[model samples]
Target: MSTNHEELTRLARTLNPQIIDEFRANRGKMKNFPGPEFLLLHTHGARSNQPRTTPLRYIKEGDTYILIAANGGAPRNPDWYYNILAHPNDVTIEVETEQLNVRATVAPPAERDRLFAEVVRQAPDFAKAQKGTSRTMPIVLLECVTEKD
Candidate 1:
């Protein structure tokens, strides 16, 4: 609550439409980003169960995509957090030009620390976000679907 998340969320709300449009239009090559790279997280609402999508920054771990709940030190967890909690296996992501079905899981604490360290290694501003927040940002693992699944 003591970080830039409020302002960042405000900006994201104002610009998400344009960013989403450009992301789709350009096949995931965003044009006017002021921060990190983004991916589209598709999920259903926690309460309404309605479909939803949000733009997010992510890191890759082998084939899995790691989504940390850091909205540049967002004031609160995004709605997608609740959505994934309600529907963990029912998730998808739009990465660049490809649409992927994925299952979501929140990493346990130790794993979160490790994964977060890796994220900060790749995108260091996440460290700044960490410094600003009292809460531990959740690390969401979007495991890819397989034919067996």
Candidate 2:
């Protein structure tokens, strides 16, 4: 598979909103074609302050939503990663019809390693992604913040 950044960005910008809506409407049953395990994440752009969404591979560890900043094994992290890093408080996320308010944080080294291992086990492409880049991919944890009913 080609890992061209511009092409991926174009494809993502063009295809992600629809995918996210479909995934949301279908409760995550609908996924990216070819890569069935990836899910789209919608977030506010930290710098532009515009809404941004990207397809990402995620795993659930109990209540926490785990994601990796692999960016298809890019040399630099994804924009969304920096966005969340700049604003660690509460960010909105949508996963298969469930809109959540969550706090995003980079997992500690040990935890990141463990979570990354689990993710690689579930989706072997992650391992390939890791190998494609020299930068250490970060394991980002999105913890849902409960709203009082």
Candidate 3:
């Protein structure tokens, strides 16, 4: 069996780019990954400092976008999670036809359950993914950043 690291690597190098390409080419809609709202999250790698773009499913709360670091219910958090922690100020996201500067923050423990439950209610697959892993999924909030340059 392939290790989780290997699987994540394969996905990062292959499927991620395909999704990203389709997302941009189609004005942010992914045909292959339908259902559940999608967003393109741009982050810098924590170790290499190289740019990384990850396609994530999100649930929006008002103007804030909520993303879960479920890693498809793998044994570990996705790489972008660490990336956000290391460079929270340098994150941005693509939604629909607009690209927006955004800040990433992990939801506090007290609030995570409520958010996670809502996600499961809308997208039941997340509940199944959660059952497959031992670690709790982290809820990440991405809020728009407006800076006058």
Candidate 4:
């Protein structure tokens, strides 16, 4: 379904705490929530410079994790998306109770389309969301920022 800014903001405020709690309590598994798996993404705010942690559905591709900036199909991108764009160097991720530094990058255009299609194929709700909005959702890759990175 198409989402508005207010609706998305409200939903985030309401659901994130619970999701984060459950993800942590269960060691990164959110039981019945949508998608295959999840991670807690910590990013510095684009404007405020404050840190924000958001629970998000993800698909793991080897060492990288893929995220969709769907914002429940909102017209605008999620705050986390802009945050990562602004401070790509200052992001971290928590998965399976393990915290690690990570860097965010927008998947290349062609790859984004392919990955988006793959994601929609796996999660039909995302496909519904895509059909609900005009904006092109971003597909982000979060790569571990190891010492050698």
Candidate 5:
């Protein structure tokens, strides 16, 4: 992780658990948190195979949830991005009170452009975060899946 990424992760580590607890306590709604809607992303470590949960801001589009690997605009993508890539099929996400079995996919170019714009429009802090980095932010979609699918 880059310095900025490390700092951001440290902050997340310190704060996300509390936020997640509060969100669950409130039955999926968040109070007094910065940014837009958030979800609890449950994934395994890419290499360690250990379970990890991350609280990330998300956008809902139909049945899929969209996330940005913004890492607060760090030079590199966040660790969860690689974890999701490594175990795309085994991911679970909690939206408010519901847990969705999901698969991760990078949005296509046109959709990436439009969805990213929609996210930034809804949460401008993401735009501010992207301004500090040169790499294009990755838009990740958590597409819902059934046992048969």
Candidate 6:
């Protein structure tokens, strides 16, 4: 099915709280799903301070959340990426049950290459995404901070 951004945004705004509640209640797992569609929330821009949330394909590497700034193979990086770069200190992530205060940083070149290889092995679209754009896609690592108990 073709996903409509406007309709999805409207529904997300209207039903996010409830959907989040359900996701939390299920222990971060969406049970009644035919696939992996109902999994993540929109991540807003921090520097421009705009409400732009794209459905990101992610995977956990150790204790970090790994994301790619592929922008569907666009020549320019996504605005959210620059926002994170500008305001690396003030970043927040909303998971199914928990909201995390995070520090966003771009992975180093060597590590990014390795991680990109791993991600492409899993989700081959990333390879296509790289081929679609002239610019090199960035791999970002979001590290969660733990507060003192």
Q: Could you tally the backbone clashes for each prediction? A: 1, 2, 0, 0, 0, 0
Task: Show the lowest summed lDDT stretch of 10 residues, model 6.
Answer: 33-42
The candidate 3 region of ten consecutive residues with least summed lDDT is 140-149
Task: Give the per-residue lDDT digits (tens) of candidate 1, residues 78-134.
Answer: 788989999998898999998898989999999999999999988888899878777
| Span of ten consecutive residues with least summed lDDT in model 5 | 1-10
Better of 2 and 4 by TM-score: 4
| lDDT computed for candidate 2 | 0.77
Better of 1 and 4 by lDDT: 4
Ranking of models by TM-score: 4, 5, 3, 1, 2, 6
lDDT of each: 0.85, 0.77, 0.88, 0.88, 0.89, 0.69
Q: What lDDT is reached at residue 129 by model 4?
A: 82
TM-scores for all candidates: the values are: 0.87, 0.84, 0.92, 0.92, 0.92, 0.69
Candidate 6 wrongly placed segments (more than 4 Å):
1-47, 50-54, 147-149
Which whole-number lDDT from 0 to 100 does residue 70 have in model 2?
84
Report the lDDT tens digits of candidate 5 across residue range 96-132: 8998899899998898989989999999988888899
- Global Cα RMSD, each model: 2.8, 3.2, 1.8, 2.4, 2.0, 5.4
Can you give the lDDT of residue 95 in candidate 5? 87
- Give me the runs in candidate 4 sitting further than 4 Å from their true place: 1-3
The alpha-carbon deviation from the true structure for residue 55 of candidate 4, after best TM-score superposition, in angstroms, is 0.2
Model 5: how far is 148 from its true place, Å?
8.1
After TM-score superposition, what is the CA distance of residue 84 in candidate 2 from its true location, in Å?
0.4
Error of 1 at 31 (Å): 3.4
